[model samples]
Target: MLFRQLEYFVALARERHFARAAAACYVSQPALSEAIRKLEHELGVPLVRRGRTFEGLTPEGERLVLWARRILADRDALEHEVRALRTGLTGELRIGVIPAASATVTQLTDPFCTEHPLVRIRVETSLRSRDIVDRIRRFELDAGIIYADGVDTDGLTSTPLYQERHVLVAGSELLAGSTAAISWAEALDLRMCLLPKGMRGRQLIDDALATRGLVAAPQLESDSVATLLEHARTGRWACIVPRPWVSTLGPTAEVRVFDLVDPVVTAHIALVTTAAEPASVLTTALTGTARETDFATVDRRQR
Candidate 1:
């Protein structure tokens, strides 16, 4: 019934582990468990299932969690609006950025902080694009930097910040040290490490490769771009990465971005927010700046 309880419930649902959820909410485990119990009693339905640890949500709990996000989002919006009137636009903005495009997350933040010095900005890097979309939908994220059209985004709106082209990168040994653009089929013949199969970006890569009637043999796989980049740096393997992201490695990190052949895959990177919710001023400004900002300038700083 209380907004605080809803926030707590949402956190527990996300963290799944009561102890960790309590830590995240800065409360003790018992207090969180008691609050959730009281909330269930008041609602006349359990919001979480019992187990040795948090196993999963029940059907009803899952449904309520969705509704809770909307209610809590509305409540937070009211508080943000009131505070904006009291002061200039100010509040915390949480954003999620996918790994490939994660470097661009700060582009919108610098200008935002300069203009609204009182605002706080928080960003979490997610390798999976769907995770970014899910967090944005749950109101856990104010906005996200994700692929332009990768997500269904039926209930959300986004503005393209830039177009990202895919690169088939290999070590000098793979391309004989010099650079050679590899076809999807040719790339498949080499050792490759890609984002985990479950990741949305991975799915995009798969679908693109499927068009060539080729499925890559991935001997090493990870959901972390940092790991993928690290492996590629050793020149022992190759990876498919987004363009512009290539320069993020250290100077010793020798790598090259090669254009894909025949069917080149390109996706627009966009700043996205839920259209169904009222956005905080910080969220609005971040979204606005992302679409208008010069990423070339910002990306240099990220490097």
Candidate 2:
């Protein structure tokens, strides 16, 4: 089957809509449909479940999509390698980032961008670490910034970036007489906002609280760090956030920051990429940038 046909099939599987798939491929609906039909004929296996409207992929299609993605990724890597030899790296580098690392991802990307001026970078933030790992396996992301704890990195190359320290933040009024460090129990006693349980950051917090025989029953829960920080600024809620975020978001004068003690929780964050041999040129470059980068110093500078 031709690469164009594989591209159309993968787009159809991703979009799950014939019209949208065609739009994504920049082709007419009939052209995309015909391409997939030809691909099916070549493979001697039906790829799509046919209907008046778009139906999901067939079992064979589901199985073949994985191979299709790998083939396309390899093809793209070859093209990138050749292009880099002639004119330096020139393509989009897509990275998935967990919410906790959103503020500090610039430490890695900044240097990568400086060295590879022709390369464009796309950072997708607020992703769960598991989701980021899954996307990397599927070849959707060149690399990811994610928590290294409790995450399966069996087939991925993980390079430790930094330790993400948790901190308690609130308005000056809410913590009017608080010390430099607050216990987990004390932080939980106040009206609090926290990340939802599904996020890795929130899970870390939950685990830490569980050790102290305390459960977080925050009055407000959100996925956005900025939202939690904003609520903290209102002097109505205390939020636990990554210390690095305080530097990037810059807590206002009324906001107070305190270390989380009595079991200070820290999550190891890493840059993860697929462990496939002969790594893509962009992924190699990103891995190099990650190695040379030190986010702890960056955070210290920001502070």
Name the candidate that leads on lDDT: 2
TM-scores of the candidates are 0.79, 0.96
lDDT score of residue 275 within candidate 2: 87
lDDT of 2 by residue, 195-302 (tens): 998888898899999998999999899999989988888878889999988875563686888998879898899999988878999999999988888778955753
Superposed Cα deviation of residue 169, candidate 2 (Å): 0.6
Clashing pairs in 1: 172-177
Model 1 lDDT per residue over 24-129, tens place: 9999999998988898899898778898888878888899899989898887778878888898777788888888777566667888888888788888887456
Query: How many backbone collisions does model 2 have?
Result: 0
Which number leads on TM-score? 2
Give the count of colliding residue pairs in each prediction: 1, 0
